[model samples]
Target: MTEHDALIFLVALATLLGMARLLGEVARAFGMPLVVGELIAGVLLGPTVLGRALPDVFQWLFRQSTPQKMLGAYTTVGVVLLLVVAGLEVDLGIVRRRGRSAAFTSLLGMILPLAGGILLGFMLPDSDMKNPNQRLLFALFIGVALSISALPVIAKTLLDLGLFKTDLGLLVMSAAMIDDSVGWVAFSMLVGPMQGNSVEFHKLLTMGGLSLVFVAGTLTAGRRGIDRLLTRFADELHGGRVLSLVILLALIGAAITQALGIHAVLGGFVVGVAIGDSPSLREQTRATIHEFVTNVFAPVFFASLGLKVDFIHAFDFRLCALVFAVASVAKVLGCSVGARAGGLGWRESIAVGFGLNARGAMEIILALLALEAGLLKEQLFVALVVMALCTSLLGGPAMKRLLYRAQEEDVVALLRRGGFVARLNATTSRGAIEELVQILEPRLGHLAAHARNQVLEREQMAPTGLGDEVAVPHAAIEGLEEPMLALGLSSDGIDFDAPDGKPATIVFLLLLAPRRLDEEVRVLASIARSVIDPRAREQLMEARETEQVLKVLAESAQRIAEERRARGPALADI
Candidate 1:
């Protein structure tokens, strides 16, 4: 490459990164998903806006072949990393907890949308398909596109609504994970054996067989091998080496899948799932990887969406509106019906529908693949992108409202109820428990001693530590007529045998009446969800005063309530 070309590539990369980050922050400030900003960043820089307004400069910066290649390389790497992180977010254990509900919801969600999309494809004009003669391929592409759900978007929305660790949240995430896994396999078969206008069935079967073997191998033997590798590195190097190993695993996985005729992202995702399932994986390590990927790779990848096609030239308003309506209605009704069939309540089913309806980044990625494969015309691709964005924006607000209606005050409010300890003078888990019990002594008298004994007994059975420097030590007592809690903050974390290997910095001492077992479980779940966000957890860890901690929790609760009220009832039609 010429020196001139290299210089232009560097400048373009810097500009794209800057614009994507700035816009992403703007999207988050407005309570939208980060992808919205990233996509818009691409649009602004693409032919639709910047290129149109400043033709010469835009042409010089992006129209050059070298600059395009550089941008493509960045996005390719970024996409692999993004997929790996998305896979890591999937928790099969959570899916198992919901059991039939997640399975049924995932199945119905895929079927109805697949049918609707295929029907819509047939309904479109020959002009709407990039390869008019290949109607089956186009129809299949549309079906796969509509059948998938975006796990990252759904998970973030659930977290924002303070339901990330709840039964409903787990069900939604697990269903989305299933949809993604199935959708990718279907996509592999659809696009892997394309030879001009024809698809070779024998080649498709070969690719399908390879993909199944890859998935099975990754989940079983591959998972065990990666776990051992990570453990050995983590035990010795103890710091950045583990991060390097994780990235290396993603690269290896991407290479294997790409060579096997499946997309490279699938490989990254499968490896990420294995990494996430590892028993020795640390929360701090996970957090570091997440922050880096979310800040750097994700923004660049999403922004790259705009660089391929001009939204203005590719968009057909009527087609865009129609496609959006079909995708949203089909998913909502199908998922809602499935959830109800699985024995969920009316409101819960509707909430699940909204959660799953979020197409977000995954749909955009699939649409891009179909466009590249010549299965979809430019207008149709733009329509799918539009549909994805609209559905993504809709899901979060809708689910928030549904959750708000069902929201009630709980033991979490004890942060505000005045049993807050600004500092804990304990270095061990047992000592922390004793300190918390003493805080309750003034009110409970001799009952405090009994509560301490009960909590210690429970701890012996299993640690209450939920990782992320948080623990909930609770026990039911005979004399208590009401539930009580003491919130303790420790600047110096205590040893609590947390699953993630993090020390306990924030502890909740909970006491419930003997018969209120159900309430005790619910309260514990609520606390877990509320503190899942790293930002919130950090705030709790750093607060100088007890009231400051209360303020943080109160503000989050208030934000959710206000947003829910503003949106009113979360209906399918909306």
Candidate 2:
């Protein structure tokens, strides 16, 4: 490339990265997904906005074929790294433990969406019949698109929303992972015909044999060999050997699948799942992969996807309407029905559907692949991109609303039915002593307040601050009408004798019945753990009024209660 061209490319890369970071921070500030910002950055840099505004500058920066190809290559690497990291971060044990539910949810979600997308494809007036098999391919592509639930996006969303450690979050994440796996398998089957390969009995048998061989070889021989190799290198290797080894394996695995006529992503995913399932390897691999992918490469992938999206084409109102309608219906019906059938309540079922509907990076990648393969028209690709963005944008608010509408008393009842709450009151702040006293003092006599203050003062002698800007103050009180909790917030923070020596701004006062020490302590511990969440802590600190503080506290408590209930009568029976 010429010097001027090289300079332009560097400038473009720098501009894109800066835009991505700025947009990401803005999105985070507004409680939105960071992906949203990356996407917007793409649009701003693409043909629609900035390109239109400054045609000469846009041409100079993104003009040359070489630069474009380089960007695409960088983006592809980002995608591979993302998938590998995603695979590494997954909790395979949870999937195994919730095998039945995960399987059921994933199957129903995939099948229904696949069916819906196929049916929708048939309804489209533009669909051609000259190549009957092409139609099937189209249908299958739609199904794959509709059926996919962004497992990584969902996990990040749940974690950001403070739902990751909750039952609903866990179930949603497990189901999404299973759904993605099943969807990939279905895609493989569909792609077979597109490749001019028949799905004969022999083919099926051969595929099955290969799968079995791969599993056995990877699990037994492959894992052992790698384990021994790593053990040997643990002391000798320091900086980049571990990551270098993983990348080598990932590429080799991808190559094997490509040679086998299946997509490389499938092989990469399988390798990830296998490595993730191994406790000894999972953390090390995850750390290495995340460090490389998220910090170094993810922006390029996101930007590349952005570059392909033609906002001008997406702006066609008629196409946008159709895309939105089909995508929304497929996700809601597919996941909601699946979740309900899996025995989730109406709200939870709806949540599962919305949560699964979020299609960000994955859908965009799939659409691009189809476009490049000549299986999809540019217009159709634009439609899909629009659909993916709409779903992703809608998911957060839908989930928040569903969670907000959940009745506290109903949650308490569920807890009781599951055996978790023995004579529990809705007012109990999960055994928060100070919160309980604050809630009860207005209705009680002065003597009660004095006694409560005495207990609190004595307990305060040995600070409850565990550091990290968190403090748990508790007191044992007798003859309480009901267990109560008082949650307080101070953004400026407060001084506490914490191990970290940081000032504790967020405090949870646990008020436990004198005799229920064990149960109350457990409850206090749960609350304390939840409060440590960065987002949750931020929300607590930002709460400007009592109502906001109470809202945050109530949501936290409800999440804890629901999680305990979903543990299947063990914690509930306590």
Q: What's the TM-score of each model vs. the native?
A: 0.81, 0.68
Writing each residue's lDDT as its tens digit, candidate 1 over 232-309 gives 766674556777888899999999988877888888888888898786676566667877788888887777778778
lDDT of all predictions, in order shown?
A: 0.79, 0.62
Where is model 1 poorest over a 10-residue stretch in terms of lDDT?
A: 515-524
Off by over 4 Å in 1: 237-239, 410-503, 509-574
Question: For all candidates, what are the clash counts?
Answer: 0, 16
Query: lDDT value for candidate 1?
Result: 0.79
For residues 379-425, write the lDDT of model 2, one tens digit per residue: 67777777777787777677766765432322122122211111113
Best by TM-score: 1
* Displacement of the residue 470 alpha carbon in candidate 2, Å: 9.0
